[model samples]
Target: MDKSDITLERLRSFVRVAERGSLSAVARELGVGQSTITRHLRELETALGVPLLNRTTRRVSMTDEGARYYANCLQILRLVEQAGDEARATRGAPAGTIRISCTAAIGVLHVTRLIFAFQDRHPDIGIDLSLTDERVDLVREGVDVALRLGPLTDSSMKLRNLGHSRRLLVAAPDYLAAHGRPAAPQDLSGHEGIRMTNVAGSDTLVLQGPDGARHTVPFGGRFRVDHGLAAREALAAGRGIGSAHRWLVDDLLSAGRLEVILPDYVPLSVPLNMLIVPQRTGIARVRLLVDFLAERIRAIPGIEQTR
Candidate 1:
């Protein structure tokens, strides 16, 4: 026989029936209707041009040819199951290079550490990180995932919202000593403020009090930077007070290198995002990296929630 018409489903049904020696039992075990099993067996026998089972009123038994065919069916089914398992194992284990693009300062301050942690869990996965102030064309740049920390516009790319981190107005101890720390959100307008020219709404700073009260203050200074790393360096040098995310200044705050502006008021919360191509979201490696990132990044000390 050419065997072209014999389907894998038919083979599995025939094998189960032969092994169990009862069509009804095979149907119950497989959770399929008895008619389905019977059809599969009938089609399989028709394709082979021979009766594979000898049926009586009480019991069913395999003929000589049927016995030989059962042996072949078991071998084929085992091979097929092995193939499926191998495919699943490969998908389950992420092992490939991922190209990532992100803002320079946060990438250095927080994202890099997270990447190291992810690599520790998945030793087979490799990451290429590109830190820049300019927006990257993920398609042309071949970036698998891009971590963005500011406002988002309409895009065809898929975005996973990790969480929102509040911005804290911070300045070096030296700068605070020189300028005198702002006691309230409105007081920030009087002091020299480090402004981020690259982000929208940079000129106006919004601060939220512990009581859920909110207010806006105009922020400007002699120092204007488009990049956060540059601004961080300037801030570290005691240039001017600037609002930064918790992740960016966690170490500095812990080490007493920098101090918060209005302890009672917090700056606007910025959403952390991971952008991926719409079509590539289902890829095993990409999906694994995103899931791992979401889990670890949300666990960072000051993150609010993964919305």
Candidate 2:
């Protein structure tokens, strides 16, 4: 085997292709031509004198040997990155790109502002923020950290509980004028409820009463949306009363565009968590940003620390 033919770039290309299962996707991610990715794969395979990836027209699958090699390559790349991080940390301010993933609405409303402030404070550190509602695999996607809402199913990653996202029942003034306001939990049954199609129990609303009792009521509407922004827009447009994260409609509430419906009754709060890849947690930039976010996120208007 020609050991010299195996390079870091080739290993990275191979790993990305293996994880993403698309040569073209890897090329786009790395900002290189597809031919470059193909050549790197070819050279790496030639050096090892074995076929690592089985390339079909539709998809790329790794051979048994390729899977093992991919694991090793990931470790090698992480070690290399950590070494660079340590070297840079010792010299001065933490300087490196930290990739972060967050839910779409939170990203747009609060996290983006926090990130901007963070960057201003530490100009040397670079941040890459990806906003998506879908839960992505951090290790596979090369994401350093992720901010997630609701309970996390995966326990393998390092976790920090920022707090719970406070939710409120809200409606526009005109909506209340037309449908009449709900005075209590049961009053909701007679009203049209704007629902989220993506949430698990969109048809049912679980609210915690002021006296600490739980109330489960049927929630349905003619209009259903999958995105928080869309739901906020629907509420603002006087579509119907709906549950919203306090941060999502805080501006509207302050501006009197939306009013709290049955202020004493509240929807069940969802957990807000920060998840970090085990290997990336110790990197200087990653650690710094995590700390920064943890502190800042707690201060958001609608975020409250769990007891």
Candidate 3:
């Protein structure tokens, strides 16, 4: 086998597909098409003169030859990354393309804007951002870091607790005026609800009162959307009362465009975290971005602010 035929891109594709077992997912994460990933794997196999994958319609796995090659490929890639890290470290400047995955809603309202500013400050660093609600495997997708809600029940990614994201019930003034403000948590059931697709299937909203009492409000209605920002927009447009994250609606609330429904009752808050593979944490760009995100995410309302 001639070594010159094997390109770094082809090797990367083979390794990622081997680890992920899905060309389609790898394509999405790499911002490429499935055919491209398939071609890369095919070319690599032809150059090396061996079948690297046992492929089926439902799944993909490495062949015996592939397994041995995979270990070597991993070591080669690690060395490449190490070289990049060492060079960047010697210069005391972090520069590289960082692929980031995050949900669509948060990406639109908050994360993307911050990324733009961060990019402006570090022009040498490239940002490859993917906005999707579906969960993705970071290592297989070649993502350097991700912003996700925690504590995740099943994930090995190392977590950095950015802060907590608080939930609040909010509605437009017109909607509240027309339906009448809910007198109690139970009253929320009587009003229309703009449900988000991410949090669907559960009709109950379990909240804690100021005095430490728990309240479960069963809710559902005609309005439902897959994106949280859509739900927030629908609520502001006088669609119905719905739960929203404080970071998302703080400006609207401050401007009096939306009003809090249950002032004394607070729904459970999820931890806003930065996730990265533990092994990759030493990379300078990844470390820089993590620190940048932690600093900026805290500046968002409801993250470090008192109610």
Model 3 off-target regions past 4 Å? 1-9, 20-50, 57-59, 304-307
Q: In candidate 1, what are the lDDT values of residues 1-307, reduced to their tens digit?
A: 6577699988978876776678887788678999999999888888899999987767678999999998787677656654554576666665667888987887887789989988988887789899986776675455678888776783878988888877788899998888787887778788888888888888888888789988988987898888787877788889989988777778788989988877888887888788986545655667777888888887675677854
Error of 1 at 169 (Å): 1.1
lDDT of 2 by residue, 191-278 (tens): 8889988899989899998899999999888999889999999999999999999999999999999999877889999999999998
- The per-candidate count of clashes, in order, stands at 0, 0, 0
Q: Which stretches of candidate 1 lie over 4 Å from their true place?
A: 1-93
- Note the residue pairs that clash in candidate 2: none
lDDT of 2 at 278: 89
**What are the root-mean-square deviations of the candidates from the true structure over C-alphas?**
17.8, 1.5, 3.1
Q: Pick the candidate with the highest TM-score.
A: 2
Tell how far residue 233 is off in model 2, in angstroms.
Answer: 1.6
Please write out the lDDT profile of model 3 over residues 22-50, one tens digit for every residue.
88978986789999999999889999999
Residue 160 C-alpha lDDT in model 1:
83
Q: For each candidate, give its TM-score against the true structure.
A: 0.66, 0.95, 0.87
Error of 3 at 303 (Å): 1.8
Q: By lDDT, is 1 or 2 better?
A: 2
